[model samples]
Target chain A: MEWLYVLMPIAGVKIFWPGLIILGVGVGIIGGFFGMGGAWMVTPGLNILGFPMAFAIGTDIAHMAGKSLISTMRHGKFGNVDYKLGMIMLIGTVVGFEIGAQMIMWLERLGSVEKVVRYLYVVLLALIAWMVFHDINVKKKKEAKMVAAGGDAKDAVGVEWHKTFHAIKIPPMMHFNEAGIYCSMWLPVFVSFLTGWLAGILGIGGGLIRMPSLIYIVGCPTHVAVGTDLFEVAISGVYGAGTYTYKGRTELVAAVIMLVGASMGAQVGAVATKYIKGYGIRYAFGLAVIGCIVSIVLKLVAKAQNIPILDDASTAVVLATVSSLSLYILLRFIAGCKKELAEIAAKG
Target chain B: MKTRFIKLFSWCLFACLALPEFAHAAAAKVSNIVIVADTRKFSGWEAWWTNLYNESHLYFALLTMALIPTVGVIFGTFADFLMGFIGIDLKSRGDVGH
Candidate 1:
């Protein structure tokens, strides 16, 4: 039992070292697979693991930066990343992020911003969940119609909102060859700005939000969204890790331990993407969002009722969801690898 | 229609950018709260790490930046190698967009 726990030098807290490894591996897989940093779950998961809230955030950001670097590199190799689009969005992301952070500082003077942020999380998660399901439903209908008309539905997309947005025809129309999108340049900039603002207020990497927007709004393919979002996450994570560390909020030893685990997990997750299609990724993402919502709600209830038990339960729920999802992705990765290798051998 | 949309979008963007200044944070910044690690029981590597944190946060931050990427690249390459040996080519994705 004594060997199970390790002391964090900077935070001065004894943590179950296994918990750190689990979180590292879990976030690495989830982030790599979903193309987003797993902060929504990791922050609460870290607090439950005995880190102070600030350290949890800083440490999570640090590990996510390193983990995202691997995912981005892998995705880039797959031609899933649109570097042109990513570069365009970088402008809005930086500016929007500053505004969001500044607003947070201002909001703090009025009252506790934590409660507001929690409520916002619930609303955002609900909206995202709805959007995901609605898109799936629409896609199914479109495919049915296409098949009924005696046509192939292989490339049918349920969410065509990007087409409507593309009609805006704002000047400086650009093309992203990787994403196969031709739209006004302002679209990506504006979309990234909006997502960046949400991320700033929520204290996250904005991967989840940005991924969907890239698909539904920016009109990118599913794989492109995941890869491009990972690129953005890597960029934001770098800035966040640097800022948090400078502020003396990060626990480096924990971050390193987590980064090592996450790095390996990222490889598995990224490779698994080769076997899973766009909608498959979306379904998994939606489930992760729902998991985050449940954990946040539990935490809120615990705070309201002053129930320590519920708070602990919230932590359990987050870790459970992370563990289960990571395991599933890992198994899928192994299966996909075996099948691919078998086919290659047959070819030989 | 395009003109109307452009005007509206520009206006909204302007407002969002300017809104941050409106809050006029009575305090120009958030409270500068600092932390100290309890290193009384620390020894060896732990003591060195905590001492660096306490003595100079800049160096601590710098080391973290260097360490995370170095470790990540090392681990990433090793994982790629293992997977490659297992017959999944690391350079090209096998079933991209599947």
Candidate 2:
């Protein structure tokens, strides 16, 4: 009975399992398609659901670690992973995580860590949302122009700046068979360092940055980029978790439970991505960023106003956003599968 | 141009390494509670040993957590590939119109 009492709060409302399911589904789909764990969504969702912020962060990282392992393994089998590039990035990632953890410790001393982090989350979310939305819109307009000209829409986006970066001859050049590029090894290391720096500073996986950088700058095929990014995320996530644990800020039980949910969710999400197309992924990614922005806004408002009611409202908004995204991903997966089956029938 | 690019890359790497040292210095001042509870209060060696053990455990925990991400990435990459081979090609599914 005493054990049950201890378990009760951990279980916290019966909705936790459902929440876990929804979180897993959403993250899995996004992660599969984008090669991101969607930790930004996971951490806040857990916090809103009555887990302490530190616990939420720790658990999110832990779950991410487990989920990434599953996803990376799946992706690797497809010949998509660039091990040399991932290893180069790993070096930078570790250094960035240690520094980021130190910054959080400094903030904690001021006793305004929560406020500062929330503010930063809001600002970052807004910025990321804007970038994703802008890119999606630009891509759409470009596709429309291609359609009008009766050309393949994919060619209109052109080679991004990062790909051009690969053409720059630099010393210590490296080749990535999966990426199909021979560029200075330093490029990936530099990108990883920057992404790691951001992840450490923000207390989030830098997958949001990593995925795009791999695709545009690193010139990785979109699928391979997704796989490699997950590899990067897993590496960085572990480092971040270790830093937090060293500070005695990690909640192990919570992290383990979340891991159970996320690992399973990741499998489904990774599988789902096989059916969804590139543009669909881009649009969904845009929507996810927008969802994050809204949730962050709600959290910021609740914190600023000292309104307990606002907290509930923020939680509701987050839950709703996660639910909608999860549904969209699942539906997209089903639709893709159906289309594939229909094609097979037509061929038959 | 090659030399210049190498210089820039090295510069970036050095900057990354330097930033963490500054952050760690700031972190050093923050006092963290070290839990070393025992069923009975003891003196001298037993107490010292207990403290040492607790500290080691904490370090172990940190190491375990940090390893998770790297391992995850390796695994996630493989998972992505497997899915791709299974005829999913997720990023291209929406392009059936072509």
Number of the top TM-score candidate: 1
Cα lDDT, model 1, residue A300: 98
Candidate 2 lDDT by residue in tens digits, B23-64: 363245335655333514545754553344356746645555
Relative to the true structure, candidate 2 reaches a TM of 0.71
TM-score of 1: 0.89
Q: Go through the candidates in order and give each one's C-alpha lDDT.
A: 0.82, 0.63
TM-score of chain B of 1: 0.63
RMSD of each: 6.2, 7.4
The numbered model that scores best in DockQ is 1
True contacts kept of 2: 0.20
